[model samples]
Target: MKIRSDILRIYQSLHTWVGISAGLLLFIGFFAGALTMFKQPLDHWVSPPAPVPAMLREQEINSLAQQALAQHPAARKGFIMHLGEHENTVATMSWTAGKPGRELDFSGKQWMANLDQEGKLQAKEELPSILAQMIDMLHRTGGIPGKIGDEYLGGYLMGVAGILYFLALVSGLILLLPTLAKDFFALRPGKNRKRFWLDAHNIIGITSLPYHIVISITVIVFAFHDQFYDSLAEVVYKNQAMFGAPPPAAAKPYAAKDMLPLTSIISKVKAEAGDSRISEIQFFGLESPRPMARVALVNPRYLVQGPEAGYLIVHPYTGVIINASMLPGKESTWSAIVGPFFSLHFGSYGGDMMRWVYFAFGLSGAFLFYSGNLLWLEKRRKVQRPNQPLPVQTLSTRLMAAGTVGVCLGTVAGVCFTLVAGKLFAAAAENINFVYLFVYYSVFLSALAWSYLLGAARASVDLLWLCVLAALAIPCSSVIMALQSPSSNNLTGPGIELVAIAMALTFIYAARKTGKRIRDETKDSVWSLQQIQ
Candidate 1:
């Protein structure tokens, strides 16, 4: 009995310390992940971009391919084309201009190109939804340059945090076992501070355990994507390039002499990918006229569930299907499981409803972290002398608080600002994103600093109000901008506008509750200071 008790105590202590260590990073990751969940919707809201139907007919491809090729003859050696989807309209192509890695300095080396909907020339400036793309890049790579160095580091941090988060969650549940026998829904706010905090944490965490588990596992897999991919290759491919996954094959720069009939190839793709709508196509080794072609087809409905979802492969010659496999049978069992893990993390395996569920759970995860900080602070206050100077907060705690609340509130504000800015600025303007990021951080930092200096009771009230105000602004800004803009169709502009309205309403309610709490507590002097000091 004594040995088991000691082991349990050790686990509890380890779990608490581990959670404290990784809490902040996990908060940021979860918050960022939640934003990523709505990236498509936010993209649409920001730029009011149109979604193109997945219709890659032979004639369309032929016209676009010819135009693209004529514009970049160098692409013949190695190139790829991504026909845009319902959410995006610009077709993108990339190719190497010379030998792999080593090219004549004076020669045009390697580059990428973008084409508009009608096989017309388009510049990178033409894509207005780049703001959302930029956010995605930041979320994925933490906006690293040269190589994905910081990204990998952040991934490691998130991975360690995820493991700790899982352990903490399990231990937390075990600790709450004593209370679980009572009313699980009890939220006895009138109880002592520790009891109240424990109750709140346990109730929220326990109720959301399934979601937490899923997010934790998926986050670790996502953060350590290299591991997942390596596992996939080891287990599924067994050293064979089974999926026609890209090979390192490249050709020396050569003049384009013979051109394949792109029209014929497009026809073949449509015929072969019957019923499954073609979302995009890529032409590889484009520096040579006879480049390898590949196409991707998505059934829309199936993709949101698992690997039974979509088909993507390289066709060595436009006419042949090189490698084909559904999500379930396409790779080894390991790869198959890993595929679903990716989808779940990105919320790509489900429809709009599932995405919203992910968003909610993500927000809840963030809330868990925020509550954790407060709980820790409250715990420390109990042992500290009243009216004495408080100990300095650790750098991690300060940063965690700043990042947690600042980023969350800033994201809400930033999205709103992007929508208004998108219409005011020209479609190609990259400054819209710059403005949004700057504005969001400015507001976030100001609010966080104010909270820290003012202390918890005052800061909580103030910052909570700030969140309410920012969230409320989303709808108001959307409405005002939509009314002023010429392109403000109800379906396009007002569709997202409605979401903003709902968010605002929720915030208003939160603001009222928080404000009332502040007013009521201030009536008592002790409750105003030392209860939370």
Candidate 2:
């Protein structure tokens, strides 16, 4: 019995310490991941770059391909085209270098070009849909470039924290198992703040357990992507060779380059591929004034057809079908499946309805981590002895507490700041991304200082108000911009509006609770005075 008691105490201590260590990171990663689902809509909200639908004409593609071939020589080695979705159609062009084994990126020279109805390339000024791509980059790496290693390192830590997170969740549920029978979905207000927080934590945690579990598994898979790939390669491919052949180096270099009619190749590709919409056409080795060009048609059927559909490639000079491969080959299929995990984690696969579901789960996970720390603090309050009153929480806990509060509140503020900057800054908004990120880190640091100086309760109250302020500012700023110039079609303006509404509602809720607590304490003071009189 004594041994069992000791074991239980040790387990509890480990849980508390690990929970404190990982709680904040888990919160930030999960919340940002949740918002990542609405990447396109948010893109639309920030900047409605006129989107093109999935359909394209052969003649138009032919001209573009021929022009690209005439311009670039390296495009023949490897080519890729992505026909944007129906609601937002856009063409992306990429090709390989003339020589292989020289560059890591298989798609050689790349550029985003808008196509006219006749498939002619539009000028650079005509197509400016990079804002959505910009936000996506921010979501992936906190908008930092050349430092993805740091982001991945954070992801690795978050993965460890995820393991700890799953453990903490299970242990928490185990502790609550006995009480669940008495209080499922129970939230009794007017109780002590500790009791209220405990109830809120339990209800949200238990209710969202399934979502939490799935997200945990997905995040783990994403964090250790190599393991996931290795397992696939081992089990499915039987540890055999790669699925697709590497494109050849200088397969066909024309001694006297001649301009190929792009129109003929499109007809040939469409006839051979059958009902497949072309996403992009790359002119292989097209950078040189005279280069052989190959056009690749992205098959839409393969997109929905279970990774078995292959693209149709046509020789622009001869209008001959060059290379064709189905999608299910070992590498292509694996790439497609693995690619969706991040989108799934962020809720980007499904439309708006799905995004909201992911957002709810994401926020719930954040709350679970935050509450876990509070539960530890509460437990310590009860157990601390006069001789050892929880020696000023370990340095790690102090940093984490501040970091958590700072990151959570700071992120809300940064999003608003970025949106405002995007509108006012316009062409210069890319720089704003960096500024927003710095401000976010600063806010997180501030939270740490505030938490250490102010009691946790007071700090929580103060920060919640600040979050409300930032959140509200997002929409207000957007609306102000819209009102000033109705012609500005910045989607970010409206996106900020949505964020502002969410913030205002959250603020109202916090204010009510804080107000009531203040009133209750004042009433208690009056009762004590009356008794003294």
User: Which consecutive 10 residues in model 2 have the weakest lDDT in total?
Assistant: 524-533
lDDT of 1 at 293: 59
lDDT of 2: 0.54
On TM-score, the candidate that comes out on top is 1
TM-score of each: 0.75, 0.70
Worst 10 residues of 1 by lDDT: 101-110
Question: Number of backbone collisions per candidate, in order?
Answer: 19, 26
Model 1: residue 431 alpha-carbon error in angstroms: 2.8
- lDDT to native, each model: 0.57, 0.54
Give me the candidate number with maximum lDDT: 1
lDDT of 1 by residue, 349-391 (tens): 5466887787787777877876776576555444445455554
Model 1: lDDT of residue 198: 65
lDDT for model 1 comes to 0.57
